[model samples]
Target chain A: MSTQTVGTAYRPSLGKRVQGWLAGRFAMIVAVLVLLYLFLPVFYTFIFSFNDYRKSNIEWRGFTLKHWANPCGAAGACDSLVTSLEIGLLSTLVATMLGTLVAFALVRHRFRGRGASNILVFVPMATPEIVLGASLLTIFVNGFTQLNGWFGTDLKLGFWTITIAHIMFCISFVVVSVKARLQSLDPRLEEAAQDLYAGPAETFWKITFPLVLPGIVGAALLAFSLSFDDFIITSFVSGNETTFPKFVYVSYLRGIPAQANVIGFSMFVIALALVIIGQIVGNARKK
Target chain B: MSALAHMGGGGAPATAMPPKEPSGRSWLPYLLLLPGVLWLLVFFIYPLAQLFAVSLYSDYPDYPGYYYQDVNWHNYVRALTDFLPHFGRSMLYAGLATFFAFVLAYPLAYAMAFKAGKWRGIMMILVIAPFFTSFILRTIAWRQILADEGPVAWVLEHLHLLSFMPNGRITETWVAVVAGLTYNFLPFMVLPIYASLERADPRVIEAGGDLYANGFTTFRTVTLPMSMPGVIAGTLLTFIPAAGDYVNAELLGSDTGTKMVGNVIESQFFKVLGGYPIAAALSFSLMALILAMVFLYVRRYGTEELL
Candidate 1:
């Protein structure tokens, strides 16, 4: 140790010192630049929300807050927003429920077909979104016609179809998130509960469920965000129904409205707020 | 639940799994797994089968939206012959995007993992913040930023770099499409690398330094290898989505020149008369190509940590 200390005690030359300094700060500099690149579009969206343009919101004309105040002024923007929220909420609920159960099973039980279950969760994630969308569209386009033929029922591709697709993809992510949490939990905690004479249902409800609630909440948030922000799959399955992203895209050819920007940026802010609050609560609970 | 309790206290070796429960409630695992598994089986697995069947159906003569059941091998032949350029462009663009995203993400992820310290949590949130906004909106913003009248073009024109761009334009070019792919998928590359790096043992790295190794040598030998699993996972995630994306090309690239396979599939499915079989065939081809590439990649550089 003394020899090593003495060896490094020799002062570095100017070039070596300069090289060392550059090496140390290099990651920090690159990180800041990358962060700027990541936020470029977000900054544009926020700035455009206040644009006072006559026709298109593409070019910056003058700055005003009217669009933010009247975000629903444009025709179908709010309707599409409502549709997205409904789909996001409904899909999040169903995916979370189904995914949590699967997570518990995979983490706790040694069952037949366990290997197959893991692969089933993995394949959807590995397949490209375009493929998923195309396949679902094919199934619905053909299946709906058959149903309409046989049962005198009019089955169509719209809200339900979009929601079903959302749930399909969201389940994999929910499983991953919840499974990570379940795996990290100490089995000893459950053993302690059993030693205290708690019933099986009582142990689950009073101990395990409370401990895992945060993970479930996080998974639900992720599922909702994914469902809301999706475009490619929804564009295919949402036959006549328009979601927020679809509305933004369809309007782009004719120039997007500033109100669309307003709603989009507002969602960003709301989501950020929710995440920050969650982090603070989590930290407080930990301490 | 009793099964869980007994397994922990059975005094069996830790490596051994618990014996199967004899209770009537042994069906719980299947019950718990049934709903989500059935959903995936119905929507994901069944839809792919339906798409394969659709890909084989031939179009009815002189009918725009009508098809007849037939074993049509011609659809695959036509897909490969007609859209070969699109398939090539998709691979090239997605490959370039994945490479560039890795170059751009690595340093940021490294800093967040080792440096940043107290600022790590905030940086993590910032990394995910862009996802809260609509991706289409973000891609359109890139279009505006790269437009002829935008700041980028104006600055480039003043700096004599405008001559490098074809027709003195950036917006409707391959560069714009590739840039959009890299930007949209950058976070997917970052988070995984950051995660693996964060989980790496710092003591192992410190040992390299203590052995009188130079910093670069230490990093190459120890740190980079530690993060390989994340790199593989990140590349796969970025590559798959970027290859399948069409919005960037549609919004930012030229309609005639820069279209990828995704654009061809989208248009064929929606626009062309009697285009269903060809589109389905094209989609199947893309999936097969991606799966093959992934298999080759994992065979070469896979880690057991990957799902």
Candidate 2:
């Protein structure tokens, strides 16, 4: 149809032009739907969080600041937020450091059984979170026998435990993220630094280390998000301790408070904003 | 230089190559390696070993070493019971999920990679934007969206497709779990496919077209074969864990039959009738299985990025 009278038709035949216009318009409609699917829930969560709904979710029941403003508010969103923050930061630090070094080892060294080492490092990546959580719990129980009695329960599950669990899985993400960057690094830079009589430490610090820092930073951020978002592993290892995800889990079943929506939406916005900022920074860096 | 000088030159190779800068640390790499190795071993390998040990014998609080000495290999034998079925179910869900994800992802990835026209960054961001929210909450929302009284149902009812609105709701159904898996993993599928497709060096396709081949033949012969590596990687990434996950089962599936090896392993570690050893045994077995396949694959393909 478009070829029927192309040169003579100015902008193709009328039918062809109409079809083209409709296709473009249809594409925009689909794009809008995809964007909506991507954005709606967190937006919904954010909007609903401001609602006064307690015993019901049928309507908004008017906006209220009670959920976010209240420090304790019967369910203690504040404490869990603090707890989640503490764990995320700690886990991020540990996973980033360890993962970076692992990437370093794979990239720099001509190690024995490197392939075997890689498999072992990534095996944790394949295993499900529940399995990991369960295994960690087993380790805590069977190994840490000396310090069991806490708050009348013969088990201890809280900050330290959750952090450790987060790190175990998170380190692998860091390793993969950093390793991808490391593989692209030029060995010539290090060789040049060494030829200039720089010490090995100095060479790595000036050349190799700086080159991989962005990846490390990205991995660190990824680890933070992963740890913050984790629910299953935390639940199994947490014993009696509760993180925000867990709190949301329990709270959802009992009655999803407007605070839950508020917190969820706020998280969504921050995450989206962070991603956008990262993209802008990434683009600027590229330029 | 010193290393070469030590090749029995009878005396430091005449010119003495800068006195060899005190080979202070052949130990540095190992030192760097120590902390991570220790963390993994103590927390990961050891616990896994312990779990295997426990699986061999039942746990009793009365037992001295935290497990019974019964030595029942039957746990391995019995993992075939409901366990094997869940494994099958998990794989089925993962398979369906990955299939759907690939189907959903391919055209989008294609458009983004080859046809999106300046909106690629936005498209890429859209692919990963789901990670911004908690997966569980998303699963819950999925439940709502797919529920009988929800949006899908409402739409279906309005469309007058059924006698009385057959509720597109499949919340606790196998389909739902797979839907969640597909939703979560669609990005995984897209990035790799788009990457491979994007890297296709369009000249090859143009050359094929110039050779009198049509679009389909060009895609099949040139594009598909070239993108196989990414296809394999993406499929493996989606399929391997999809086969192991229990989150979909726990959140979306109806019966225990939907539970996968992941759920069973998790249960061994935590659920009421939990068995640590069984969990370990199962995990080790699965790990060994994955390691074997991945090991063979790496041998064949020469990269460990399959995950």
Candidate 3:
């Protein structure tokens, strides 16, 4: 379109022409710069993954692959990473199941108190993590003890508390994502299945479930990421247990070991590879 | 088999006029909803109620970590009186970050929506790929990238841009905190805006060009208005998390001056012995404040629909 204007009979001033040229490319230029800005820290993390720093991973010491070879060489890095994965997996599984059911109920069937249910799902997402964490801590500390009135019966703030908190938050995200996918679906497809003599159970299993599987998978992935990346709420409820983020944060006072960087970068690469593979599989199915 | 045949006959008529509310086994929805609602009521709703109760509890004078049930409202008073500045800083920093994120994200989202064409999927992957890394690691990376002796500071110093800075450094300042907030939540802003813009009809935008109005005018009047829902959703998403965040401030900013409400809540809960009541009070206050602001903001500028 811009090319069509070139070499036209009427010509604007040089300043106007320059302004027009810039205006044409403005969005792309800003997009490229913003993309660079977004990746700046990521690049830094990747580059420093090879740093051979005895004390700190901050400075670019001469490069070495030893950290990459033994990513768990840092004192508690691997332990914390394993703990985070356990919590993340447990929370994601529970949250995805609960959330997907709720999403189906809301989208597929009408019920009393539907609006109230929506608000319940939304309020958790709107509330800050600090508030959620603090509230949960208070409950664990005194609320449960008051209920049971039994010494040593109160829930301890540790692995269970952290997993519970992660599930509590992750449910909202899963519900929202799955609800969106369910809403966008064409009801006619299900109707078509019914018209072909499939019963409710068969139609659901064969038709609706397959269509909604992508949304469920996406929601599960979202839940896992939210649980895994969470630090604030986990920090509050994790009394003695340390997660990966918490370890990195506490270790920051003393310079972080390069192993932390190595692990972080590896996770990034792994997730990216998984997403690309999923896309390829999806494209192949389409073809 | 007979019941199935009858149901199949009923389904054909229903398709011509799609039912607004699909009638099925009445018990099924309730069954599906029961477990999730129970979990939420126990964990989320009940915990909030307990927090409110704890906020009103009086401290047991001799015991530092223990408190008794009492209707002592003074915790709110103490939280407000002591940590007003932290709240103020949180709002200010979060607002600035939201504004900067909007500015930076709008163009990128716009480009991805209209200009990327074949590269749109890859662009999306690129935007979201950063989330795969630990946010703390990324923020700390910013500390290294923008170190006082780093190239950014060096270039700024040579360009005379360092005059505006209080101590001629970027690492240990509010600027760094705001930058980190903006950086961390940039994807939240971008995704919603891109989704809305991508849904928009390209012909509508071309119609603006078809008319006498120029590019900027068309955008101001047409494109921006169409994407207002996205803008509202994006701003709320970015601002809410950024406002409550402490990690960026703790990692990037100085110790005292840049502390936010989250930091105060964290320390009050974790560090201070008899700080539970006050921390709970502060948490309630922050939630109420954010909810009220969100209510008013939505009432004023909200679209008919949002995620």
Candidate 4:
């Protein structure tokens, strides 16, 4: 792998060596700058969680631990966070299950509309959130009204509606992630299991399920994140309900409380910890 | 069960069993697919059709909502005429942000893919870590950073760069919105490009150099072409979301001039009463336009695998 001339024992000139060295350093410098740019806002959000501002969280007020000490001090912020968590968990469960099933069906056993189903799965992922939200709103509003007219029962838009929207969107992402994993699987392992007199069910449970478990877990994680971080679609369908993002949007018009920053930074730290742990475990397994 | 029995016969190895045919009688795949497809049918496909129908409805002047008339086309015309500026702004901002994201992401992705060596995992964690924070909070941080009295404006003012800026500020300007878009979506651009570049054979790149091509020349000929699929995916991911994003504009841009089509649709649906038909029309039009553009772009630059 060495670029040095083997026979001639030739060495590059000082200027050439320096140029080569700089060229390598240049990529590193650009990468550092880009990474810095990406983290600037995150850094700001983390640091400002300690700000002791009375009114606005925008300025560099004197530092204090009051925000973190009472993270739920802001009236509706923690409630909204809880709501988001609930929606995220419920949607992740539903989406992961349904999406994994569809993914298995697509990758393992093909049906008549498999190609069309693939396209159908992708449509939700590709369509803009605004369009998705607006379209879903039309359905809910019209459908709910018709139901009310027919049954004299009120079906309101709230947690259930937002959860549904989240699941609808999260399904596509889960399907894609799980499908990739399923496609990459070695089919021979299943055959080998079957050759050992294992029933199809036993083979699947012993071989295929364990292998695809990581994919399913990864997909579930992705679905949870997508559901948690959703804003626009949740906004459209979440009538008279506030999720974390909705709380931030409404609070932004005024100065957001530092407690919100506390929540944001805490979430970031938790997610970072989870990722690092996942990576360590992944690397450990590889070893 | 029969297939399992056949495989267990021990006369022939189970490994030699041909892949299952698609026409097999097992209904398991269909059963598995049922819930997911049904969910999509009810929420995604059905809503899309309802949206189209709503788009054709006419607004009842005295009422809070619209009534469905048969296939009224004037809603599309009115949306086009009235909100043309917002549509144009959305495309312009999204395009500019995509370009900026590409410029920033390419080198970072390249370094991670080719030069980071053992630091790749840590570097990837850094790239994705910001996304764990709430997107709204990140943009809100940008609002603070780009505020007129904030550090960015102060530095620009002192450095004499504010002369070109409208009203000598970054907040409430298209610059802030675009910057937010670029920053927020940079990870989307980086990850895919990095994936493609990381998969590229190092020997192929070395072969380019072995042919007496300079670094830049080798990159232009070999690396860039191999990474086109990633580039295409990244651009589409960034542009589509950026175009549809109203968060940046709402948070950073002034209410008067910086409205994007997303903002228009949002306000139409949530803020203005009896604006449902117009909003639906706008949504339909935007979807159609984006789909058409994506189709054309994909046809031009995409590989079959990408499709």
The better candidate by TM-score, 1 or 3, is 1
Worst 10-residue lDDT window for candidate 4 chain B reads B1-10
Worst 10 residues of 2 chain B by lDDT: B1-10
Fraction of real interface contacts that model 2 preserves: 0.25
Q: Provide the lDDT at A72 for model 3.
A: 87
User: What lDDT score is found at residue A259 in candidate 3?
Assistant: 88
Residue B80 in candidate 3 has what lDDT? 91
Query: Scored by CA lDDT, what does every candidate get?
Result: 0.86, 0.67, 0.83, 0.84
lDDT of 3 at A187: 84
The top-ranked prediction according to DockQ is 1
Clashes of each: 0, 5, 0, 0
Residue-level lDDT of model 2, residues B111-137, one tens digit each, is 665567778877877666666666666
Residue lDDT tens for model 2, A1-287: 67766664665445445544533454355444554665555555566667777585535579778877863564777678788889999999998898788767655565455566676677787666666777788778655575544334455677899999999888877777777666656667878999999998898788888887877887887788889988878987897788888887777667666665656666766877777798899789989
lDDT of 1 by residue, B1-307 (tens): 0011111111112323434756787899999999999999999999999899899999878777899888999999999999999999999999999999999988898888888899998888888888889999999999999999998899999999987997779999999999999999998888878877877787887786555346666677887888887788789879999999999999999978899999999999999988999999999999999988887887799653334
Query: Can you list the residue pairs that collide in candidate 3?
Result: none
| Candidate 3 Cα lDDT to native | 0.83
Question: What's model 1's lDDT at A68?
Answer: 78
For every candidate, what is the interface RMSD in angstroms? 7.0, 11.7, 8.9, 9.0
The per-residue C-alpha lDDT of model 2 at residue A244 equals 84
Native contacts, share recovered per candidate: 0.61, 0.25, 0.57, 0.59
| Consecutive 10-residue window with the lowest summed lDDT within model 4 chain A | A1-10
Which pairs, if any, clash in model 4? none
Error in Å for residue B8 of model 4? 40
